[model samples]
Target: MAFPKELYNAKFVEYIESLKILYLVDDKFKVICDDYCSSKMKTEKYKKKFEKYFQHKLEFENLSKELEDEILIYLIRKG
Candidate 1:
């Protein structure tokens, strides 16, 4: 699957080259990105069952936001 590095904002795709370099050299950053993508996927999955999975969707959305913040911080600092 393609990386979901560009899912958050335009800056991610704009800095694609820098992101590629960081992904190759930073283990923690890679983990954060992967977790962000996973949380996003889970959120989408739960979204289909809005009533039944409301809590699950909300949890994943929060997790996704946190992970996205970490990713942005790393990109700003090291990308």
Candidate 2:
């Protein structure tokens, strides 16, 4: 899908790349991320959630001020 070009910021891609590295090098974190993706795939609800999330977090985007704050708050609360 063509993602909107106004959703993610620099740190978002950095965080995602860090997770990718962890998924490759750390077995424990790999399991966590793998399980996260797998479990989310098991239901339509989570599928939509992941879809929307990644769509908003693609590596290239000039996110707006409001959205950047919202994403930070969401990630902080979830983390």
Candidate RMSDs in order: 22.6, 20.3
Which digits, one per residue and each the tens of the lDDT, describe model 2 over residues 1-79? 2222222335447676575566678889766666665554566677788999888886336466668989999999999
TM-score of 2: 0.39
Give the candidate number with the greatest lDDT.
Answer: 1
Off by over 4 Å in 1: 1-11, 51-79
In model 2, the worst 10-residue window by lDDT is: 1-10
C-alpha lDDT (0 to 100) for residue 15 of candidate 1: 73
The lDDT for every candidate, in the order shown, is: 0.77, 0.63
Candidate 2 collision pairs: none
Stretches of candidate 2 above 4 Å error? 1-14, 45-79
Backbone collision count in every prediction? 0, 0
